[model samples]
Target: MSPQRPTNPAMQRLVDFYDPAVMGKDVGGRTLAQILAWRDTRLESQHDYIQVLFPLPEGSIFNEYSPVVDEETFLYLRHDSNDGFKRAMRRALARMLSFYGFDITWDQDAAGKWVVAVDAKKGAEEDHFPRWVRRMDHNHLRITRILRSLRVLGLEDEARAFFAALCWTFDSYRRIGDGSMKFWRRAVELPLHIAPDGTEVDWLEKYEEKKEEKAEE
Candidate 1:
């Protein structure tokens, strides 16, 4: 069956942008695939794409033009019925990982059950990737965005799994500091409680959150 259209026009456009089958472009007139194909320098320099790729319920602080995630869009993206969209988001996550010079792979753990791990790609250390992850840079903010985005978008398992790998990497390398890692933890564990309206309640936003609860009560 074809993907269902969304009731909200802005959300409809965002959904098409994310769903590969729909092949919709963002406000910048670039397809998601095309944006992913951009070189690392371009990826680093181009700030707006990250917001488009890993949107949140709230607007981005740095990018004024970022798309805001809406209730209808959130439901459709997170619905188990749309497995394809989830897979597409996963692929997008991997691409972002690669941009940071990390590669994700599955390997058997102690019990031989397969598990996910993120490691610096072989020879990637010769370049600036390792140093970048180590530095107190804007990359951490991007990581923050994606991690939270993955969780809110219904890939919580994948987000937790990636965090486990990151934990291991931090322990083994001792590069990324404790302060930076805290953001990662908060993003994955953020309580995106679904409100009656079918969207996540941003617990961090006291004003709006209180308003919603007051209205409900």
Candidate 2:
């Protein structure tokens, strides 16, 4: 039987992104799985794929062609209802995490909402940690996009969990470089709530420091 296609082009592309059996392509004409299969060097060099892998409610600052997560589509992809999307999201998350020499784990609370936990990958080459954490680059912005996308797409707990991991990296990883933390803070609470440009930092316990610090070379 042929797959049931979505009437909305954006919805159809989204289905292509997170649904494995659908062979549709993102706006860039690459499937999500194809993007995921890219090596670290390609992942590092490519600028457009991040916005597609982890879309925000608003258009991407880096990639203009990015798909925005509007309210109607956002509500339709509910965590309580859509386990397949959750699984596909997990794979996407894991792909990014592993790229940065990290491993992922998941848990469920009483309500059964899935939550993500990140850890440094064990037995990684000695240089892996430094390569991922020491430099300030596009990955930092990618982190922001990932967090907000997770939240807007009905994975709030998972977003919070990922944020907690970022908090740890900011402090412990050392040399996270300048300006990354501020961008990350902005990610959790973009001007809009979960709508296009919507972000919430209400759950964060402490306010960000007014003065920023520079990481050592």
Candidate 3:
């Protein structure tokens, strides 16, 4: 039998979230479309590793997109019981994106429930990320950006908390996967290395390690 197509509605919502039309906005005086285009340029050699959480059936390419979260997480957040967490998460993401200068908005769907909405500040070029980078790496990049943004906004303590929670979450996930530990040492301890002048710190560099060590349960 052929592989059945994924008709999960939550997957569709995830795709919509990553759509260029929805993400087109001006960030930091430069259109998000423009910045995405820049990112695409940077994705030159890393192009083939981006994995799609929701891959369409063979030969069906319309509306294809990969979001930053997996399907299970997406559905969990969208479920009725989790709406409260969903709303808070939406606000958190919107706040982070706004700090990067993107104009984000939310809209009520046909069911009278609010969903994420985005608008561009100005017309700009198109942009896309390669298919090679999966959510694991994608999320790391996002966390790094959020940390840098928080530090820039003078919320160092909050940044540290967020970083700690994020690292703990990663540790939990890795531990669940194979009773391994990867992020605890370098990642969880990163904030301690911040320099007074902010010149000696390599925020992105150390965060790239993905080694998995056995965790002492």
Candidate 4:
């Protein structure tokens, strides 16, 4: 008999869990504890981010340009529960943001809660990318773009939830093989645009065209 494929209820649950308005509320409340507990109970795995080797081989010139990770730290994050991993990530991002003293806006209601917003941002950022491995800089850039876009759209909570999903997807890919890495590369290669219907458009195509226009100019 053929081996059966595991049912991916997690994927379905994740899709349902990512309601933009709901996510926004969670972020505004800074309810990471609740979110983490929810994810743990539903997903049953603590790992929320994934790791993959850069397309370039080790020791290649590109390797030097890529980001690096502390192997032990990466392993710990990979194996820890979702809550523990999120906390660790928050601490790391807090240290990085403290260097800049940046102010993060969690929501309109949180205007007075600078400390809370910062704490939440640090946690969210860390939770989204717990391990800083090589080739993961793109992941950060993607996340930063998502957050900025959310701010522009006034969808702070949705942005938080989206970032959470992104991190979760990344983690899922890491657990899978290099095939997952290839999938991410392909996904990123495709242009992402926002449609009038509130869907993603081929924004990358527009980006390429603008670059070409600039080159011609």
Candidate 5:
């Protein structure tokens, strides 16, 4: 059966960009290029302004950066409640990962049950993809793009709820510092936008203010 478009405007926006015919195929060439362009443009715009605050390498290349996750992270998505949104987001995510040269695989248990797993499609050295980007904090470019895509697809609430569930059950990450914890909490509670000086802005507040002003008018 063909994938259905979402009723929500946000999800609908994403579905519009999505090519149902190419849904499960590899995510590369034009597909990956567009998103990478979006991600890189945003980061490059802030590079000069925020360099002092978060200095990355002098010249970094992150074109090969692929955000791969463990199998268990997708377990909750199997639930009936998240059916539509999960299907959409997972497919998009899979495409994104595939574009970055990740492969979809499965893990088989002793009893013969199998579950989804992610693997690097290439066996190249880490040096070739040295600028590995992980979901260490909200400053990540790739993750932000993924979430933005989901929101554009009209899965804003569903994506947020899924993220909350994932974070709550994250059993892999070790305890980070208090500062990082604080940043993570703030990032979660509000919509994030980077400032000229690399400070994180709560765009949600700005959005509400705009809505209120419009109401007043």
Candidate 6:
């Protein structure tokens, strides 16, 4: 069977998200066609590995251009029956991306549901890991600062929920068969928030610090 092509609507959406100028030029020294070729190659070679490493949820939309939740935990969240949780999740994700300096554009589909996409940054590096991960790490300390600001601005719930979702996403991606797992394992932990009162700390940081202290003793 022949490979499927993204329909006109999907291609138009991609063009809008990327904008004409950036999309017209190459990304990371490779044309869009070349990058897509590499992506297709990896998907083919790692199909089984991806399945075993991150099994698809029941009734998942896994084909081209469909949103996929690779982590079991995140899959649960995405499929959660709680409307509030889902709305909060969407808001949190948008807020998190905005905080990271990514321009998020949304458009209503035929059903009046929003389809969101992040505007592609120019001159961004596209390596083995997703460009999103690399950009997040580039502003690692600033991410923490943003969380603190959100908390101070009475948006602690948004911040917490965002970080929780991100932690799960990172945990899921880190478990995949990529050799960059170690880098993700370290990079992902950076956005963990610190309590302002000093009475509490990020759960992961506290656990890690205690482990190190125990080892040193």
Best by TM-score: 1
Instruction: Please identify which of the two predictions, 2 or 5, would achieve the higher TM-score against the true structure.
Output: 2
Give one digit per residue, the lDDT tens place, for model 1 in 12-32: 778888777888998889988
Best by lDDT: 1
Off-target runs (Cα >4 Å) in candidate 3 are 1-135, 175-217
Candidate 2 collision pairs: 192-197, 192-198, 193-198
Candidate 2 lDDT over 1-217, as tens digits, reads 2333445688768866787667568877888788889998898888888887787656766777888765445545643556777778878888988887777887887999756677767755463555557657767777877887876666666677677777787787567865777766766654335332344433221212211122221
User: Candidate 3: which pairs clash?
Assistant: 25-120, 49-132, 49-133, 50-131, 50-132, 50-133
Judge candidate 2 at residue 130 and give its lDDT. 56
Candidate 3 structure lDDT:
0.35
Off by over 4 Å in 2: 1-7, 108-115, 123-125, 189-217
Structural similarity to truth (TM-score) of each candidate: 0.79, 0.75, 0.26, 0.23, 0.32, 0.26
Tens-place lDDT digits, model 6, residues 1-217: 2223234452333222223234432212333333333443353343222211111122223333322222323323333243443343344345445433344455789999765545433432243235345433433333443344333223445455445544554564553333333333333333332332232233335544654689899
Ranking by lDDT: 1, 2, 5, 6, 3, 4
Alpha-carbon shift of residue 15 in model 2 (angstroms) = 2.3
Off by over 4 Å in 5: 1-17, 21-90, 93-141, 148-153, 170-184, 191-217
Better of 5 and 6 by TM-score: 5
CA lDDT of 90 in candidate 2?
Answer: 77
lDDT of each: 0.75, 0.68, 0.35, 0.33, 0.37, 0.36
Error of 4 at 194 (Å): 11
Task: Give lDDT: candidate 3, residue 103.
Answer: 47
Least accurate stretch of 10 residues (summed lDDT) in model 2?
A: 203-212
Alpha-carbon runs more than 4 Å astray in model 1: 1-4, 106-115, 193-217
Per-candidate clashes come to: 0, 3, 6, 5, 6, 0
Between 2 and 4, whose lDDT is larger? Answer: 2
Candidate 6, which segments miss by more than 4 Å at Cα?
1-129, 132-136, 175-217
